[model samples]
Target: MSDTLTTIGFDADDTLWHNERFFALTQSHFAELLADHTDHETLMQRLLEAERRNLPHYGFGIKGFTLSMIETAIEVTDGHAPASVIAEILNAGRDMLSHAVELLPHAAEAVEHLRRQYKVIVITKGDLLDQERKLAQSGLRDLFHGIEIVSAKTPEVYARIFNAYGTGADQGMMVGNAMASDVVPMIAAGGWGVHVPHGLSWEIEHAATPEHKRYHEIPDLAHLPKLIETLTQGQINATS
Candidate 1:
């Protein structure tokens, strides 16, 4: 294992940019479209269920989300949901797909500052085309040394990606808004895991706060550099 950090992996959705909020917006529209078929609360619950059921088949990102919504609509309406409602659902998904990228506060600054010291990479989970489109739109794509859009964020996956991108998981760090996907697995892979909450997250992405030395929570990415530096110093001090 290295004595200090070498690679820094960042989650794209709701970490470096606004993501969940768009999902929230589209979900709201979905509820409205089917307001007569089911109440918002029940509709949302069913939609969540559909997303969980469909995740393995469809994977992550707007396309999967859209299919989940459509599935939910058909379920609530007993396959009687109007063609218009289905059309609106498709439209909402497309709108989500094309929405302009809005970088979270201090995202660019923190990544740029960190990259000067570490091999910074984007290890986000989502559809390849949509994620690549968002990265291109975010204006920060070129700042990264690598990008890995994977199906899931497991310990083995993190270890593999970290090893491929930089040194190894032991000397790498992963930053993101989702504890389940970003923090937990990365820490489990023997690296630092920094939780930068975006205040909005998909329920499926939620995980309990881990009680581990390598796990950390920060209000936002703005604090990432300082936290990394402090951790680096701590590692140096312990080794010395």
Candidate 2:
């Protein structure tokens, strides 16, 4: 274990469990309800655009997600959707949003492994209430030493977290899913980062990767413990 890596931060949503996939499935069901007026792809695009517009108002959460689906459903339907279709859309969105909470495979094990040797912190951006509820439901809420639920994950956020934890850039590592929201800012803040790409990421987060030595990309949560062990081993070797 690396004594140099005193603190490690993790992303919550897609990093710890299934998130955007649920939204995508809900959106698919929602688009089906409005297929008479708009196709699924078009409906999804408009909803993404709408979400970009609504971010300032809603932050991040299922409430905003469901609202975006309803907004897009109404917009695409051109006011001609039957009450049944609208009800179905609402119910489907709500059902998915209220999805039974569970942890991703290996999330618990990886966290346990890291926590044994380092200060494990969760740095996630989302609606505070929704995030808290999910964390509570996932049954891993007690595992983390520090939790950062923020409105955004930017370089500033990374810097603040590093400073608060009293760790320099070399001693702090970030693990998250979105390149745009997670890796980019951590790199910009001069911190090391691990990218665990989700199966479905937001279109906006699909940006060109900036080259950096401290960045490591892994396939999924199952590989995380090994990756961390390797990185931590290197850090330990360097210090010793």
Candidate 3:
């Protein structure tokens, strides 16, 4: 793939390590805290609604989620969310912030392999400090050529980052778990988009898959190297 692909970007959260799972667990904790006020299903729906409303204001990360939980708590309980509940919510957010980084299966090896052949980078959207901390603990930091903690991953953002860090998005490839943030936008920016699914996904991140030739999906990160080789050979065949 070196002949056609110059850069490879990986999404740092669920794509590399355990991320959404923790969010799921935290949401569970949130539901429990508000059990007296609302049922689990109803609380989750309301929490999701608050997140949608506040995303533009707070952006993505534990801080935003914590605020959304508090907002939902207030709304569910008729604007009388308890001080102790708020305190526990803050505590849960802190726990999420300080959670240990656990690498996904084959995450390290896949990144190491790709970096040897391409300009491997991390293109993720989250709180900057938390992202930096996670990278520092991930043990895969040095394997990357660059780390991008974007507020959001849009087509323009992908284009700019790829051009600034490598050649351009056209010769770039991005692998991540979020179709909306990672795969679709990169494809829109004229790069190859590879989807690597995780067991848990946030509903807000869902989008209809783009019907594009450059889009591909792998069962796991371990398959990335082989996919690149196949694409590389196909590129050679087409050009020759």
Write down the RMSD of all candidates, one decimal each: 0.9, 2.6, 1.5
Model 2: lDDT of residue 4: 62
The reply for model 1, stretches above 4 Å from the true place, is 1-3
Per-residue accuracy of model 2 over 1-240 as CA lDDT, tens digit each: 124667788898888988888877877777767777877778889999988888889877777777777777777777665778768867875676567776777888888888988888899887787788889998888999988899888888888987787475457888888888888888888877789888788886776776887888988777877876887788678878
**Full ranking by lDDT:** 3, 1, 2
Residue range 1-240, candidate 3, lDDT tens digits? 234899999999999999998899999999888999989999999999999999999999999999999899999999899999999999999999999999999999999888888999999988889999999999999899998998999999999999988999999999999999999999999999999989999999998888988999999999999999999999899889
What TM-score quantifies how close candidate 2 is to the native fold? 0.89
Which candidate model has the greater lDDT, 2 or 3?
Answer: 3
